[model samples]
Target: MKLGTLVKPLLITGLIIAGPAMAAPSAQQVLAASPVDDIVERYPAMMSEGIREGLKRSPQLPPMVADTIGYVVSNSFRAADIEQQIVKNLERDLSGKQLEAVEGWYKTPVARKISAVEIAASDPAAWQQMQAKAAELGKKYKGTDRARMFERFDRAARATESAVDTTIAVQLGLATAMAAFSPDSANYDELKRKIENQRNAIRGVVEQQVYDSYLHTYEKISMQEMGLYIDFLESGPGSAFSKTVTQSIQQAITDPIESIGNQMARFLAPQK
Candidate 1:
C-alpha cells in the first residue's frame, strides 16, 4: 500500500506483478537496464531537510546538534551503497527479460525525458514547478473527472501507488528512528501507537504527493511518450520490473530502521 519502510537517519522508505518467464536478466544486465541507479542517485530528494526538521521537534536539542543530523541526511546519506543493495535485492526476484524490458523502456527517448524531469522534481525548483502544474492538472480533471484521473493512472506506471509507497516508507522510517532516538524521553509504546494512529493521515498525504509528483515528472514528457510508459507499466515484464524495484526500495528503507532499533537498544543498554 505504501513503501511504509522505516529506513535510516532511522527514517526512509514495495510492488507487485507476475508472469511466466523467459530468461531472466543477469545481475549485470539488470543493473545496466534498470533505472535503479537514477533512483538511487536522485534519493536526496526524499531526504532533504527531513532529518533536521524532525530533530527540530526536540525542545532540548541544540541547533548545532540538529545541524549535524541534517549534515548526515544531506551530505553523508549513502544512497549509492543502498542503490547497489537494491540492485542485488531486485535481481533476486526479477528475470533478465523482465529487467531488460524495464531497462529498454527507460532507455527510450520518452523515458529518458521523464528521467530528466524526475531528477529536477527531486529539487526545490522542479517540485515547485510540478506543484503548480499538478494544480492545473487537478483543475483540468475536476468534478467527476477528478475521480477518473485518479483511476487514470492505474496502468500508467501505477505512478500514483509508486509515489505513495515511497512516501510512506520514508515516514515509517522517520517515525521508527524518532522512537528509537528518544526511547528514554517518552513511552515507546505510546509513541508507536501515535505513529500507527496517523497511518491513514500519512497515506492521504502520500496520495496527494503522488498525484502532484506524477504530473510534475511528466510535465515535459509528450503525451505520446507518457502513453508509451503507461503501456510499459501495463505490460507483464514492465509490471514485474516496477514491482521488484518498489519492493527493493522498500526493503532498503526498512533495513536501516531495523538497524537503528537494534543499535539504539544496545546504546541504551547498561554497560555490564
Candidate 2:
C-alpha cells in the first residue's frame, strides 16, 4: 500500500496511545479504532488554512508531506500528556505562579504565530535572510564571549533540530509497523518481522545521533551555567559544594542524559 494509505490508521494509533486506557492496546487495535475524518476535523483552523496555502504555493510537496504536517500540527496542538510531564519536571524548581505562567503560553494563540514562522522558515528567500542576519550578528559581536556563546547556541539549535527529525522518523517507523499487523493478512508474521527489524534499525540510529549530538551540546551548556554558579559560591560568603561534592554533583546531573538515551533506545527497540 502507498504511504498516504497508511496515514489515517497511523493517526488513529496515535489517538489511542495518547488517550486514557483501561487496558493497554496493541498497535494494530489502535490503528483499527482511529477515525481519519475525526482526526482531520480536529486540526486547528490556522493549520488547515496553512496546509491549504502550502499545497497551493509548492504544488510539488508530496501529499505525504501535507499529511505528515497535518499529523504533526494535530499532535503538537494536543500533546497535553507530554506538556504535563514537562511542567511537572519544571515545577520541582519553579513556584506555583511561575508554573502557571509557563502553562498559560500553551493555551494562547501562539500556535498560529508559530505556524506563520514555520511557513516563513520554509521559504528559500526567508531562509537566506535568516542566514544573512546570523552572519551580521556574528560580525557585530566578533571577539566577545557573547559571540562564542551565540555560536554554541546555534550549534545546539541545529543539533536539537536533528534530534527532532530523528525522533519523528522513529515514531513513524513504529507507527507503520503497528499498522501492518492485521489478523486477516495471510503474511502477518512475515510483515511483523519486517516491521520489527525496521523499528530496531530506526531506534538505533536515533539513539546514537541523540547521544553524539544533542546530549553532548546539552552537557556543554549545562557545565557553562554551573561554572557561573560555582564562581559565585567560591567568591561569596557561602560555598555549597566542596571540590569532591562539586565533582560528584556535576557527574550526577550529567550522567542521566546518557541513561535517558539508553532508556529511549530500549523503549523503541523491537522485541525479539
What's the TM-score of every candidate structure? Answer: 0.70, 0.27
With candidate 2 superimposed using the best TM-score fit, by how many Å does residue 224's alpha carbon deviate from the native?
A: 16
The superposed Cα distance between candidate 2 and the true structure at residue 127, in angstroms, equals 6.9
Q: State how far residue 86 of model 2 sits from its true place (Å).
A: 1.9
Model 1 scores worst on lDDT over the 10 consecutive residues at 12-21
Worst 10 residues of 2 by lDDT: 236-245
The lDDT per prediction is 0.60, 0.37
lDDT of 2 by residue, 148-176 (tens): 44334433223333334333433333333
**Which residue segments of model 2 deviate by more than 4 Å?**
1-61, 76-79, 92-129, 151-272
